[model samples]
Target: MSYFGDIYKGIKTLLTGMSVTGKYFITARKGAITQQYPDNRETLKMFERFRGEVVMPHDENNEHRCTGCQKCEIACPNGSIEIIWDRQIDEETGKKKKMIDQHIYHLGMCTMCGLCIEACPTDAILWAQNYENSVYDRSQLTKVLNQSGSKLKAGVED
Candidate 1:
């Protein structure tokens, strides 16, 4: 009698587990409501919480918001940012000021962690919504943000 009761209890537990599995099998046929990645980009809406590419915004006057403080450089953990800056006299005030001599950012090494943006006191660094960054050559990924021909406006912080 005792042996019979043990077998009966085992059968009862197995049936209970199978019942749950069977229920889900039927419901799953109704089609998944989950979002499709990448392909559904046009239909998908990004939330405010999403953090993407880092962009250095230039104001209407062409002057950037960066003060060339080197705070972002110091804050970057991966040493991805190399800011070659020098002190120049502010033409308006005649006072020595920080000027961005050169700005280089390597996308291949960047972690996209937004630490650089957060370190910026003037809100110079912003995160853009573009995420499709694909390049064949590693050298192409190394971007010089500020160049001679296309300098980020003048009289930024200087």
Candidate 2:
């Protein structure tokens, strides 16, 4: 309660804080718990469940499973997904069928929410582990999920 007593208490508290910092400083020589980012780039790995980005998986023949149902586009809160499709006549049946022209994913607008992945009925879209998504231009963030000349696999329906 006294002025000197209060001053002494403050000094003690300061010293206590300093002691913890000094302890860490001394122990840091043994091995730093903090990772040196660029140095650890080779060994660093992201977690399995980490939601980095949305991607469409394709088979060996470049055939994707996306039905272009627009579920992912609707589920996205930020409108990060855009499904561009067209009706084509199937040669076998001669029936008009919806085929995905392009599945555009805007990485810059994405919030890393897994709603799009969950909304995909055909399990077309999934979260990829590659987290580094930085780019100089915003236009570069808009990615087409399907590879060039890729097509839907046989029997994938809307």
Candidate 3:
């Protein structure tokens, strides 16, 4: 009797799952939740809050907001972010200040956790919307966020 009861329960559960799938299949033509990729690429849009990749925004003057504080680097759990910095004299204040030489991001190791963005005091880095990050070479995943000859924005250190 118990063996038959187990079989009956298993069949019931299977049918229940099938019914849900059947309903979706029946309505799929009307309004399917599944997206048709490549064909609908032009119409596709990612959500605003989607975390794609980390990027540093530079202004028209090639100035960024990063103060070389290293908070973002410290917040990263996987050591995906590396900030190469050096102390230089600030022309405005005549005081030595930390400036970043390179802001490196290893996309291969990043989990897209957004902790680095949150830890930044100057909002130096944020998520980019471009999600097409596939590459043939693993070394290509390593990116320098800061542009060459880019300097820290004035007053960002204060």
Q: Which candidate is the best by lDDT?
A: 3
Backbone collisions counted per model: 0, 0, 0
Model 1 lDDT on a 0 to 1 scale: 0.76
RMSD to truth, every model: 5.0, 4.5, 3.7
Rate residue 93 of model 1 by lDDT. Answer: 75
> Counting only residues 3 or more apart in sequence or on different chains, how many pairs clash (N, Cα, C under 3 Å) in candidate 3?
0
Q: Which stretches of model 3 miss by more than 4 angstroms?
A: 1-30
TM-score of 2: 0.75
Q: Please list all clashing residue pairs in model 2, or write none if there are none.
A: none
Error of 3 at 22 (Å): 9.9
For residues 26-138, write the lDDT of model 1, one tens digit per residue.
89868666777778878776666566656676655556666678898999999989898888887667998778877788888899888998898878777777656787888
What residue pairs are clashing in model 3? none
Candidate 3, residues 55-91: lDDT per residue as tens digits?
Answer: 9999999999998899999999999999999999988
lDDT of 2 by residue, 1-158 (tens): 69999999999999999999999889998867677878888898888999988899999999888877899999999998888999998777899988789899999999988999989888988889886789999999999998888877777763
Would you give me the overall lDDT of model 3?
0.93
What's model 3's lDDT at 67? 89
